[model samples]
Target: VSLQELMEPEAGTNRTAVAEFTLLGLVETEEMQSVVFVLFLFAYLVTVGGNLSILAAILVEPKLHTPMCFFLGNVSVLDVGCITVTVPAMLSHLLSHRPTISYGACLTQLFFFHLLAGMDCFLLTAMAYDRFLAICRPLTYSIHMSQTVQRMLVAVSWTCAFTNALTHTIALTTLNFCGPKEVNHFYQLSCSSTQLNELLLFALGFLMVGAPVVLIIASYIHVAAAVLQIRSAEGRKKAFSTCGSHLTVVFLFCGTGIFNYMRLGSEEASEKDKGVGVFNTVINPMLNPLIYSLRNTDVQGALWRILVGRWSLT
Candidate 1:
C-alpha cells in the first residue's frame, strides 16, 4: 500500500503525501528583515541570559531555598526551553530567508513548545496555591507544603505537561498532510489536519489549560477576599504588595494563552491573529523572568547578592 493509503484507509482515491513544508515567516520586506534580525537577536540573548541568571541565583542562594523559589526555578527552566524551541530557528529563517524546516524538526519543536507551555500553566497554578496557603494558613503552611509534597507537585506538573504534549504528537503523527505544504505561520508542524489530533489538542487544553486557569482564578478570588478581610491599613497594604507581582505575571502569561489557544477553532483568525500568536510564543517567555526579577523584591535581592558575590571573587 502507498503512504497515502496507509494514512487514509477510507479514501476512495489516492493522493500524494507531503514530505516537507515551507514556513511563511513574520515579514517579507528586505529592508525590515535586517532590523528585525538584530532586534530579535538582542531579545533572544536577554531571554537566555535573564532566565539562566535567575536559575543560577535560585540554586546558589540559600535565602531563596523555599517553595516559591523552587517553583520560580522550574519556571525559569521552562522559559529557557520554551524560547529555545522557536527563537533560534526563527532567527535563522529571518536571516537566511530560507524557511524550510524538516518534518522531524517541526514535530520536535511543537512537542517542546506545548510541553513547556503546559508546564508553565501548571507551575503558575501551583505557585498560586503556595501563595494562598502562605497567606491563609500561615501556621500550617510548612506542614502542608512539605519538601516531599512540593517535589511531588513539581513531578506531577512535568508528567502532566509531557503527557499532554505526547497526546498531541501522537494525534499529529496519524494525520496525512497530502496538500497545501506551505504553513502560514512561523512553524509548520501545527498545520496538519488530523481530526483526532485536533480533538486531543482541544481535550488537553480543556483539562490542563482550562482547569488550571479556573484554579488560578479561584485562588486569586480567595486571595482578594482574604486581603479585604484585613482591618488595618498596614495589613491590607502588605497583603496586596505580596500578591501584586505574582498577579502581574499570571495575567500576562494566562492572558496571552487564552487569547491564542482559546480561539483556535474559530474562523475569525487572520494574519494579525497569527502575529499575536507569534508574539505570545516568542515574547512572553522572554518577559517572564524579567517581570519576576524586576517586580519581586526577593528575586531582585537574590540576584544582586549573586552579582556582588561574583564580582568579589573576580
Candidate 2:
C-alpha cells in the first residue's frame, strides 16, 4: 500500500494522533537493500570493535591513563552510542516489508541521538582545551588538567548535552503531528508551525555547535603560536603530530554535522546531503579509532604490546 493510503484515516474517523512512523529505508530495491545492508553491517561491526579496542587499550595500558586518554575513552563510548542509536534499527528496517517505529520509540531515539552527538561536540572542545594546556602551557598542564578537573570537564559536557537534548525533545513533543507518519529525512514532521523549533535550532546551533568550533579554533590558535616558538624542527613536528589526529577527527565530524544542521531550515535535504549524512553517521565513527591509533605511537605501541603478549601466551 502507498504511504498516503497508510496515513489516511479510516471511515468515520477524524484526524488522529500519530502513533507510529513508517521509515523509508535507504534503498527501495531488494537487491540494493541487501548490498547496502552488508556494507553497513560491516561498517557497524568495525566501528564497535575498533572503539572497543581503543577502550581496552586505554584500560590495560598505563601510558594511556592520562587526562587526554580519559577523554578519548569517553569519546569512544559516545561514538559507539552515537552509531548504535540509529544504525541497528535502520539495519532491521532494511529487511522488513513494513518498516515502522512507534511514536514514543522514535522520540526516544531522537533524544539519545542528540544527547550523544552533542556530547561528542563538547568533548572535542574539551580535548582541544586539554591540548592547548599541554602544548601552550606545558608547565601548568599537570595542575590545570588534574584528575578532578578532568572529571569536572566531562561532567559539564554531559550536563550541557543532556539539557540541550531534553529541550529539543520537549519542543518536538509540543508540535501537533496530524498526518503522514513517514519519516524520510530529518525530524521535520509537524502539522503546526515550526518557527519555535527553528529558532531553538538556530540559537542552540550557536550554543552547542558554533560555540565549540569557536573554542576549538581559539585553542588551536594558541597551540599554533606556541609550537611555532619551538626552537627545533623535531619539537615543532611533535607538537603538530599530537594534534593532527584530533584535527582530522574534528573536521570529519563537525564539518558534515554543520552542513546537515545548518540546512535544516530548508524544506527538504537533497539526496547529496543524505549521502553526507551516511558518511557522518556511518563512515566517520569507523574512522576515529583508526585515525588515532595510526597517528599516535602511544596507542600503536600499546596495541602492539597487547597483541604480542597474547600471542606469546597462546
Q: Rate the local accuracy (lDDT) of all candidates.
A: 0.77, 0.86
After superposition, candidate 1 runs with Cα above 4 Å error: 1-14, 181-183, 186-193, 265-269
- Displacement of residue 157 (Cα, Å) in model 1 is 0.8
User: 75, model 2: CA deviation in Å?
Assistant: 0.4
Candidate 2's residue-wise lDDT over 176-198, tens digit each? 77744554466556668989989
Q: For model 2, which pairs clash?
A: none
10 residues in a row with least lDDT, candidate 2: 1-10
Q: Give all TM-scores, in the order shown.
A: 0.89, 0.94
lDDT of 1 by residue, 33-147 (tens): 7887888888788888999999998998788899988998998888888888888887887777776676677679888988999999999999999989988888999998999
lDDT score at residue 121, model 2, on the 0-100 scale: 96
45 Cα displacement, candidate 2 (Å): 0.5
- Residue range with the least summed lDDT across 10 consecutive positions in model 1: 1-10
